[model samples]
Target chain A: MIRAEKIFKNFGDQAVLKGIDFTFEAGKTNLVIGKSGSGKTVLLKILVGLFQPTSGNIWYSDINLVSADKESLRKLRMEVGMLFQGNALFDSMTIEENIRFPLDMFTTKTLKEKKDRVNYCLERVSLEGNNNKFPSEISGGMQKRVGIARAIVLNPKYLFCDEPNSGLDPQTSITIDELILNITKDNKITTIINTHDMNSVMEIGENICLLDKGKLAWQGSKDEVLISKNEVLHDFIFASPFLQKLIENSK
Target chain B: MNLNLFYHFGNFVIWQAQIFKRPENGSMYYKETVRQMYDIGIGSLPIVFLISIFIGAVTAVQFYYQMAGSLIPAYYIGYIVRDMTIIELAPTITCLVLAGKVGSNMAAEIGGMRQKEHIDAMEIMGVNTSAYLILPKLIASLLMIPILVCAAALIGILGAYIASVPAGLFSSAEFIKGVRSFFIPYNVIMMLVKAFVFAYILTGVSCYQGYFVKGGSIELGQASTRAVVYSNILILLADYIIALILTA
Candidate 1:
């Protein structure tokens, strides 16, 4: 479990995250959902140590991430994995090499062992035979899967994904969501995903935190979403007339 | 402007400290260094050859024209060409050109990676992005640029031979005699010293510009331009300082 304690972030007098206190539970898809510019990305970045909060403590279990020293942070990073919004796979590397990068950098494994791990990751992502293909040669959905494979190749204890479904179609987005959900359950990893996709929120948002204008506005599960009385959550989740009408009709 | 200069200089010094840290994996750095060597060294051969030849030809031809009917012997053209190429033109001109070619390319490549969030991805994976990205390029330039400068000096002397000897401006023997006259081995050492310093400036400045780049493609383009411009200015400045120190 990862706990964020009174996290306050400010960029030159403009506060982005205002005293957000929350706990992301292990073995579940913990979602941070909000409209654009609602501090979702900033919160996620702070949690992953990409950005330091202006004030507050981030407890990755017992360790305080905000105060961890360099060596400690380095060790912690090995147990951490992230999937970028752009699916930041190395364009120059093949799918197999991309998946094997972490192992090659941080392991004492021999070439055969590394290759075996790479193959296993590829198979796990359901891109079993597409080892030699470069990222550009694959479809966007396939590239997302490759990103997932690379992220999980290290068997990280904590997984952070930033906007995993931004440019993907709804169908592909759902597939990616399911994949992440399964990976979290299978590995028992503490997974925190930053997304605004309602389909993702309704489908696999086992634990959800809603931010409105840099403050935590609502918090609940997918089941609580449809019946929630939180105005901010309602405005964000049912922003479109169609979604609002469907929610109303279903009620 | 003064404050901005100090800010950049201070940041650059701090960044250098980060870049020289111990590598996470020696073999990975070695592999990257080899790749960079091929890119910065072999990839630059054709352009270096073309420029060096012209530099030698022009220097010899211009000197010969000025020395015509003077007290100085025609053979001095070869000697002058040899000294100039080795002492100044070969290292300085070659590095200036490479600041535009290799330096700008390094900036763009790293800047593109930054814009694409590749660096962030590596950082999240526990890689020292600064050391991993810049060190290999630095090592490659340090090892390759001096060799390239030496090649340029030799090709430049050959170019002088081709332009002067065959054109009947002087006999081949006279030019050869002039080349053999001023055999000061110390000048070659000076040339190498300049090459090493210039190599460090170009690579470090370029990598620094790219690694800290922010925003979109336009910003990246500006960073690449700054990398080349700053590298050239510093190279020339260092060239003057080194010449003074060595000559003194």
Candidate 2:
């Protein structure tokens, strides 16, 4: 599990993430959800060590990831995988090579062993036969799958995804969500996904943390979302007039 | 403006420090280096050759015109071309062109990767993105650029011969004698030193520009332009400094 205690982030004079505490449990999909400019991305970036918090402690299991030494940080990173919102696959490399990159850099596995692992990852993402294709040759959904394959190829203990369903269609978003959820359960990895997709929030949000104006507005599972009396949550989830009307009519 | 310059300089120096870390995998670095060598050396041959030939022909033509009816021997044109190509033109001109070609290219490639979050992905994968992206290109430029300068020098002399000898401005023997005359071994060393210095300047500046790039396409384009412009200015500045120190 990863824990953030009293996290605060500032850019110049403006604060992005206020003092907050949250736990991302292992073997479950933990989602950080917020509207635009709600500090979800900043919080996620801080958790991933891409940005430093103004003052806070990030505990990855036993280690304080925020204050870890360089060697310790490097070791921790080797066990951590990330899926960027842009997919972040090397455009010059094929899907097979992209999946095998971490292995190639970190493992002494032979060519056949690496190939088997790459194939396994590809198959796990349901991109089994698309190994030779470049990222541009594939659809955006397939590219996200390839990103997942690359992320898990090293068998990380933690996975951080930034906007996994941003540009994907609704059906494909569900598929990607399911893929991440399954991977989290299968590996018992500490998975934290930063997203604003309401479908994702309702579907696989086993543990959800909601942010509003850089502060944690609420924290609960998807079950609490419908019945919770949090005004901010209500406004955010039922923002559209049609959805608000539907909820009122049902009430 | 001076403060901005100092800020960028300091940042560039700090950035350079990150690239010297031990590689996670030697073979991967080696593979990248070899690919960079091919890209820098083989990929750049035609342009280098074309530019060097023109430099030599132009030098010969202008010198021949200047020496008309002068007491100086006609063979002096070949000697002058040979020395100019070696001591200045070959390394300086070739690198200035490469600063535009290879330097801008490195900036764009890395800047694009930055904009696309490839560097961030690599960083999250525990790869030192700075080292992995910049080191291979640096090694490639340092190794291949001097060889290209040497080739340019030799090819420039040949171009002089082709322009002057066959055109009956001077006999082949006279031109060859002029090239063979007053051959200073130190000039060759000077050419190589300039090549090495220019190579470092171009690659380092360009990589620095790209590595810290921020924002969208317009920012990236600005970074790319800065890479070429800054590298060119630095290369020329280094040339002047090297000449001052070495010749003084």
Q: Report the Cα RMSD per candidate.
A: 1.0, 1.0
Q: Candidate 1 regions off by >4 Å?
A: A247-251
lDDT of candidate 2 over A1-251, digit per residue (tens): 99999999999999999997999998999999999999998998889899999999999999998889999999999999999999999999999999999999999999999999999999999988888999999999999999999999999999999999999999999999999999999999989999999999999999999999999999999999999999999989988788878879999
By lDDT, the best candidate is: 1
Instruction: Give lDDT tens digits, candidate 1, residues A1-251.
Output: 99999999999989999999999999999999999999999999999999999999999988899999998999999999999999999999999999999998999999999998888888888899999999999999899999999999999999999999989999999999999999999999999999999999999899999999999999999999989998998888779889779878999
lDDT of 1: 0.95
Local distance difference test, each candidate: 0.95, 0.94
Native-to-model Cα distance after best TM-score fit, residue B4 in candidate 2, in Å: 1.1
What are the DockQ scores of the candidates, in order? 0.91, 0.91
Give stretches of model 2 more than 4 Å off: A248-251
Residue range with the least summed lDDT across 10 consecutive positions in model 1 chain A: A238-247
